[model samples]
Target chain A: MDYLVTHSPALIVALPLLAAFAIPLISRLGPRVRAVLCLAVLGLVAALVAILAVDVHAVGIRLYTFGATAPEMALPGGYMVPVRIMFEVDGMSIFMGIVITTVAVASLIYSLQFLNGQTGQARFYSLMMLLYVGMMGLAFTGDMFNMFVFLEIASIAGTGLAAYRTNMADAVEGGFKYIVISAVSALMVLLAIGILYAQYNVLSIAALAHYMQYTTLDMMALGLLAGAFVMKLAGVPLHMWAPDTYTVAPAGTTPMILAASYTSMYALYRITFTLYGGHIDTAAIGWIVIIVGVLSMFVGVMMAVHQTDIKRMMAYHAISQGGYMLLGVGVGLAVIADPVALANYGRDAMNGGIFHIINHVFYKAMLFMTAEAIFFRVGTRDTNKMGGLARNMKWTAIFYAIGALAISGIPPFNGFASKLLIYQTVLSFNPVLSVIAMFVSLVTLASFAKVFYSAFTGPEMPGYKEVREVPKSMLIGMGILAACIILFGIFPGLIVDTIVAPATEALINQAPYINAVMGAAP
Target chain B: MSALSYEAYAVWVPIVWVAALVVIGVIVLAWRNRGQKSYKKGTAQTDIFLSGIKVPPEEQRHVKAENVYWGFFEALKGFYSVLMRPHTGVVNDYILWFVALVAVAILILVLGA
Candidate 1:
């Protein structure tokens, strides 16, 4: 047990992967036993995340290379390999892992009943576990190339989950589109990786960091990587697949996608600022991101406003909120040239960007799960057909309001804090973009207000007028997610200082991160 | 999250910068602008073209101002289509995608050598 604590990062990745494989074999066992085992795996991962988080806080950055190979020079001369596939735990990665694993726990609990009559329950749970494995792997791993592998793993699992219900044409179509778009992104990322490997022989982020000469090739590689990530993040122009996919996929799966969206974005942070080491001038690319972000915000929200389906609206808004995140990243780059401004804009802007990704995951999950409840009771997610759901599903209504308020960046919510920082950073960095972002936020607020007014308030429609509260499993998931949103809102500084701040620092402070992986030069 | 925190409460206080005061003053301006627009509408409202045969305009051709992107969406028709397809959404296709992806990884690994 003590040994496991020291190697908890492995447990974090392992328990889920093992469970995923183990579930199919256990199909012959009682359903209750298999379900308990799934819960236990989630519990173990959650415990591992908490333990690793505490350990990282104490140790600063807990590096556990895969296969227990120590970081060492593989051959004589300049050649060195990072020990194993390192599960490098800084505050940010651990925090993300905690959120991801915690959410998986909730979703699985929600799934037990959701998948009650659904055939292939074992397969579904297996895919869920696989997704968690990849998500944890994505968050914890320090290397860029390794990140891609994990992404592929997660994407495969996600695609499976998206198509879990093959009877629905929407699910099948949505899942296909999801896989194709994600594959295209992965290909672009691979080409970028190829370019990087040619420039720097080693694939380890630490090795790349040491070789941070910003040649045109390096810049081109970065461009490819960024383009790919934007697709994965479902940033503007590349976000066409999300609305359909979210609408069709099981509601339990939608939150994971939202979580995955930000995780990919975080991977980009690791790539650009960490591996490349702020060496490449990215003002041009950042400006492009800002424009895209602006477009995504207005465009995504506008499209969302026209949606009668509730899940689709949340999906589009996910894309829009994604814009807010990238806008922060863009502002960080555009304003971070001067040392004085760099400290303020670079660190603060990145903090806000990263924090918002985490914040969005919580609130968005709450909202999605609430939508799930609506669908469960009303047997539909059509806003035009729903009204006065608050009267019956009081807890759901409260949770949904919390999600809506938080997402809209209303005061005293999680979104408000992050958006405020992002807005402030943008305003100080470039007031013009800030002005555009402010209008975008206003549109977002207005759009969500429409959602609330249409679906929760307004005149009570007949068909779903007698809708009862959802099962206990569903409420539990929504409740935890809603609680997370409220906790993050008031005490953001606490989480930000520990998790977001450290992650931002890790991204920017390249020297230490590189050394931590590669060790000092002989 | 910045070291120099711009606490909203502090920034939003009454006794702030001149620009801040000017910005605060715009709420009233916007309010007044809305009021003026409403007043203009009050006088402007009349039967279209003074009781001429009033054919209701087609819903699609409504003359209200709409977003520019409403038109832009059609221009970027290719872009909009990207959101929709590759749609034979079989689980087997996903498996194929993964297998192809894995093959690419192996190819990259071998070719890199």
Candidate 2:
């Protein structure tokens, strides 16, 4: 058990990577075998992450040094800095790990039938595994350079998946746009890492955070890191690539991309809170985040209402929902200096943001799966062409309604719980921001209601008379997420107490992270 | 099972709201049922009505999805027009937006610092 706990971090990432390579070879056996292999591999990764989360909760941060005899050995010569690649499994990282693994498992199960009989099945599964590996590695790694490497891996694999359907010219175009944006963002991140390494002679995030002096170069590097991550996170004015990619990607793969986006959002929060906390102007950067978030919420949803394509509208909703996270965390960051506020409201705000990450994953994936089911049956992405599908696709309709309610922040669903936290906390910080968030939520409901009315309710359309419900395996995949949504919604306190609170603590407290990496501070 | 509590704000079980909804729904259902005659299928009473005139189902105009929010869109016509102008669906424009954002972020950070 101790061995499993000790090596879980490395195993969680490494096992999937090994399986990703092994998949193509296994593909020669049969497609069914390949599908089973993918599921088993992802299931194992999920179990490992669950174990790691439990271990991190039971003890504390789990710091594993690569090629070291001991996990916490920072320096061979007893030097005061970390020089080796380390996997730092804190509460926050483990929280993100659980989210990624859970969503990846569900997505892989969904793809079993969603992409059945399609050509290049083996390649699709392999790329999916690689994307999973990249997200897990990005979430778990403590080194900045390692993060950049993982980001590249995720981006490349994601681009391939987005362009998987080569029959569609738009798919190829979307992939091209994604790769261009990813390359530029990766360069910016790499430049930031280089500047940090040149200044501190270290690639370790915790080490640099401890030794950071907030110089001019450090500020520039911070901007670069923040901008690159924000771009990757699909923040508005910069979110133009998202709708195209989401619309073009295979249905089963969109959820994975959403997970990847959240991983980058996690990086953004990590950079702001853990890496640069107390060393920079929190209010200035917080306001910057808040502004970006505000714009994203307004612009993303407004554009969504105008979109006729169902997947594209959901894609815009993704950007808007991401804005809520940024806003919640930004409010917390903006008030970090006030101990009273930090204790009373800031922590709650951060909790809201982090909680929303998991909730959004479940509901958004469900929504995408529902959209896929609609597309599968109706053979169209346009809502105008899809009416009264509920008569045939009963399960799909129910799942879509659950997802629509959840995404719109309606009560008795996960989105409402998290958005409530964000609203209450941010309202105390600034009433106007809360008002904007509420307005956006209303618009979100209207947008999804548009989808519901067009795609599910009203009179049955002429062309879809022959359509039926999606396959059982697809329902099973969506059922998992729908169940999670209901559970998380009904037990918000449990989730907040168990997962979000510790993660929030881990993010705000940098001293323990630094000490874990560089040894206890003398 | 436990409720979400932050400071003085508490959201316990959703049962209360559910029960209230059930009760209100029952009342509404009962009220509508009071003194109402059951209409037979394919009768004049069952036909659709527009401005006090019955219209045949086949001939009735079904509201399109785009028309559901027509009033809202009409009210915000100017806003939607300007907001959507930049979403050109072109890769070059997307990159331009990204670079412009990065520049704005850098400027904010540098100047704020």
User: Which one wins on TM-score?
Assistant: 2
- Which tens-of-lDDT digit does each residue in A1-522 have in candidate 2? 889888888998898899889998999999888878888878777878888888888899998889888876766566677778999989899889989888887888788888876899888988998999999899989999999999999999999999999998989998888889999999999999999999999999999998898888888888888888888999988898999998888888999999999999988888888899888888877787888889999989998988889999999999999999999888888888888888878889989989999999899988988998888878788887778889899999999999999988887889998999999889888999999999999999999988888778867677778998888889999999999998888778778988888898887788788888766544
Query: Worst lDDT window (10 residues) for model 2 chain A?
Result: A71-80
Stretches of candidate 2 off by over 4 Å are A520-522, B1-12, B15-36, B51-60
Candidate 1 lands at a TM-score of 0.81
lDDT against the true structure, each candidate: 0.74, 0.86
Model 1, B8-60: lDDT tens per residue? 44753222333564787898788877754433443546335636766554332
Please give the RMSD to the true structure for each candidate, in Å.
8.5, 2.3
lDDT of 2 by residue, B1-113 (tens): 11236323544465554467689999999998785567677878776667977664641254667878989899999988888799888888877876777677777777877
